[model samples]
Target: MRKNKLSFQERAGSLQEECLCFCEEASREAMFQAPIELPEGFVIDPAEAVTNVTWNADSLSCVSERCFIETGPEPDEIAVQFAVRLQGTVTLLVSVSPVRNQYGQGNGAVSVIHSAEIDQVVYYSDEPDDCPDFSDIRIENLVVVPPFYGSPLSVTGTIVLVPEPDQRSYVFTANSGDSTVSVIDTEVNTLVSNISLSDIPTDLGVTLDKAYTYVLHGNANLVSIINNETLTVTQTTPLAGAPRKIQFETGGEFAYILAGGSSIYEINISSQTITNTFTVSPAADDFALDPNGQFFYTTNSGIWVVNKYDIKTGQLIDRLSNLETPNVIETPLIGDFAYLENGELRPNVVSVIDLTTFSKSSQINRLFDGLITIVFSDDGTRAFFLEPFPENLTVVDTAQHTMITTASLPGASDIAVTPDNQYIYAAQPDDNTVTVYRTSDYTAVSVIPVGTGPAAIAM
Candidate 1:
């Protein structure tokens, strides 16, 4: 049966409220009176003690609108030294007049200056009796952009921009603690679907070929293979114990489940069941598969590298121990080497594993207090970590294996990298906010609110 695919679109900007305007204008006029009779308490300061004096006025014809001015004793010639300023009680004045021609033709003469210095000014209007015209005007515009709001849940799991036929990116999130998956319309930045699952899902791995998604249920002790097309649970394969991490092989025919002890469940996609189980020496919390499917790395009580067997033999080829505490093991896409982030204190480390030798060649430590999640960039040039508890995401340059940038997450428990490598979404379990950051400059763009205890983030 053909499936009806929903279109997902990317949002241009976040949601916000409408902006307000700010245009206003005040009128003008001219007048001359008794200095606007001062009130009982309006006594001016002594002229000798004044440091500054200012005035403004509007004028028309013979009348001049004057603003009150007071200043300390100064030179009589400096009466025009009043300062210029703005206030609700102050205004400017304009004066106009026509002057008479010297050849006995009558015209008006006009002069303008600070009202306080009007006595020092002179007007030579040719037509002294003629009155010209004058007018006054005042003008004001408003500004517009709104505020951004997000969900309340700490974003755990991943967000993928699955391009739909309609040109939208279908956004999805996997919550480890909530044990629920949220589907969002990227274009609208709105939640459209929330899929409920079993106990805390630690890992989410999706495959488009078979239209199935494998979820490692950390507390449920099972691997849920969900049908992506139908958005329904197709099968739940029982594992040894808590399956904290799971990944699908490149061929898309088999899946690997890493559980509590030193065992890993190898399930067959055809039968939708666990066909064989491989128990390596030490136990592991997570595992990663080499893109080539020749070798798989699991973080046991230490760390172990196991070779793929022919069938249900459940035999391991090579394993390494006494290494650093390993959390998530991933193989960078650009090179054959693998990267591991140990989520332990004191000797917290990240190691570079040579796939061919199955040995740790180089390692860096104390990069952070705890690094439980590590994600490589799309091009495999950089790697990211979700340091739990003291919530923060740190990015490292893969070539140098050195720390590059760090972002504070506060109650952050997990992080997810978008397929495009544009944003890193971090989940804060206590704060219940998913912070989105730009990967290039590592600037915080937005904080998305979500439900309580967001435990995982993926994309």
Candidate 2:
């Protein structure tokens, strides 16, 4: 049987709301904003493209179930063509801005613009999938159709882009009390390995290549690199001042470690040798880098503030205060904002730092007091707050700075979301297990047993 492919053709600068008018320069998955001119000669063509594009004042990560083709802009106006892969009968939800420039810059915000359901069936994929067939048909001139308010279970009908499972299928947790690291495979919800370490692990991070997992021991003042293939600690680097967090460059070319409460040690990946050292405010044990590794943020408890520094120029960019503790700082993959937990001895607050203007935009204080830990979804649309009021979880809508949902699960210490945005894995130390909750309904789907006293989690 021959498949009838849907071909998309759009005119530049003024794209129809129905076409795939997404602009991504760094990665295939783009967080797009209209009227924001993109660089010239932007291009990418692959055998299969699954793009999760975000647009608007408050942003979101959205993806369709089908595959798409790349479309570059013309000189003046933007034109794009998308060949979407289909199977049976599928409904796609898309938000398009009224295009305004040749660079596919949208003039207006991407308000919820949904297209009506199409009724056509065709041969979608050459092979079969475990999931149901949604669409595989043919259509033309897919101009602006009637607005579609889709399925209730779809969560505002936003097509959630699922990342490649082969690369990010395992959730890593650090059991500080047990001095061991447990690897949980999300595919089967089973414990793959309980790696016993020599020292208490404080934090964990996986390399970009998925080749190794780096474990930092703050008390022992050393780092252990575990080879994922062997599930064994292959190499160990001893450091001073109680090393805290481990970060990698985008290409896995270099690694940076925060140690001694006031220094960042940079290591060349190829040689695993100390390439350079940089100093920061004393008593600052935690630091975070922007997604591109161009900027860094560190907390200075001496003044109870967080400082943003330009990594290239080694100059301060902005400083944030009003925090009681100001010990921890984190940024999302999109690099638009920073999340800092506040009020260790006071009220629990999470300050949102606007990266563009380098200022404090808003503070989320709805969470309960005691201890607050937040983990952002892949696209920055949502954040999971770990509240210590007898162990509970709160889901906040990042765009509106509103609480979306809540779950009371006793013993939940820390939380980490899957790359696909489908599930939340919370480390329950009180129960000596990790609870898996479905993002769609906040239901506990699985409670897999893990090592004791799980304190931290990473994807």
Candidate 3:
């Protein structure tokens, strides 16, 4: 007898009392089963499907037992399609002729026939709705292409999904010689306020929550915590020695301070007390924390080495030696690699280290002379480095390990890229101005005058 194939077609509508049935002719001793797969942001109840299953989101339980909905990353406004395939097989019990068990009982074993692709189901999100009703939403050939993951660093870059806006973005500049921090409204391209401090601010570290900005005073042996919203100093916590650099953990619960030239101090932000301290040989010129907050990378200027230390125990986990006066270090948002700017006294090269192996992966050379500072795009695709001697900004592609282009900025002392990766801001202390360039075209967008000696910028 010929087996009849099963098929169904329906228009897009609300999933209400929808049932898809699969039937096939079989003998009395035969059984059949069909398994289904779902897309990324979807789910199906096992009770409704009568089989093993996985769900995209748990909140969709209130919607329908058989329905799969969008609950993962934000979907593009344009139509997206998902393909589903169904696999089916038959099982049967067979008994050997005249075979008896030792206990005088006939024995039989169950066997399954090879499964084959039986059906194809395609789902289309062609309509504009947060939760569109899927038609005959059953499990089978599951195909899904998620929307873009993050915003492009440049205009020509790939599209990415960005986080929802909550708080306004502002630029924080640490004036090393002026003993003050200038706050600039990035949207307006103007200076909004100048925060006064007792000592010169050497570096700036913003909390993950963006609630507080920590300013390290190079001469005062203190870290000033500034409330970002009110733009005022909330508290000042004294350290063991003058802090060379400050790095915050992802949770903002504690901060790691490289102080007193050779010791690392971990401070609890809420209690404003030193919780732990670890000492190292010689002082580190710069350092950066990994994304997981498990370890940190510090550069020893004297010995020309980069040491990795465990954040909890302060134990040296790994070291990349044989470097040339590693002066500045930066890690991208992903934290998979570290980019170290070797000083001009040594070769003009940026040592790239793979965080996983803690080894020098490659070197980006011929970037510029007299390397002042370096900053990365939010997505970690491009790096912007400042060379004050030549007064130029060099942009390097992180993936290709090559120089992309160089732009001229007179007296470019420091460089910073916005969180949205839309613009690049370079501080020219000689000109006493900050020049903004569009990331897409590297063209000058605007210039705003700041206080004297604008040395560092934080976003």
Using lDDT as the measure, name the better of candidate 1 and candidate 2: 2
Candidates in order have lDDT scores of 0.52, 0.61, 0.63
Candidate 2 residues lying further than 4 Å off, grouped into runs, are: 1-168, 248-252, 269-271, 312-318, 321-325, 343-345, 365-368
The deviation in Å at residue 9 for candidate 3 is 82
* Decoy 2 TM-score against native: 0.59
lDDT of 2 by residue, 1-459 (tens): 112223343233234444434433212111211122223332111122122223221222122323222211213222222222222212333333342345644354232333332222121222334222222112222222222364111112222222222453677889988999999888899998787788899888777667778888999988887766445566778886688777776657777788887878777766657787777764584788776778788887567888777766657777777666775677766557777766666566777777777677888757456444667787878878777765378788888777887777567778888778898888887778999988888789999888888877776
Q: What is the lDDT of candidate 3?
A: 0.63
Please give, for residues 222-251, the per-residue lDDT of candidate 1 as tens digits: 777666543455676777688766667767
Alpha-carbon lDDT of model 1 = 0.52
Q: How accurate locally is residue 442 in candidate 2, as Cα lDDT from 0 to 100?
A: 74
lDDT of 2 at 127: 33
Task: Evaluate model 3: give its TM-score.
Answer: 0.61
TM-score of each: 0.56, 0.59, 0.61
Q: What TM value does model 1 have?
A: 0.56
Q: On TM-score, who's better, 2 or 3? A: 3
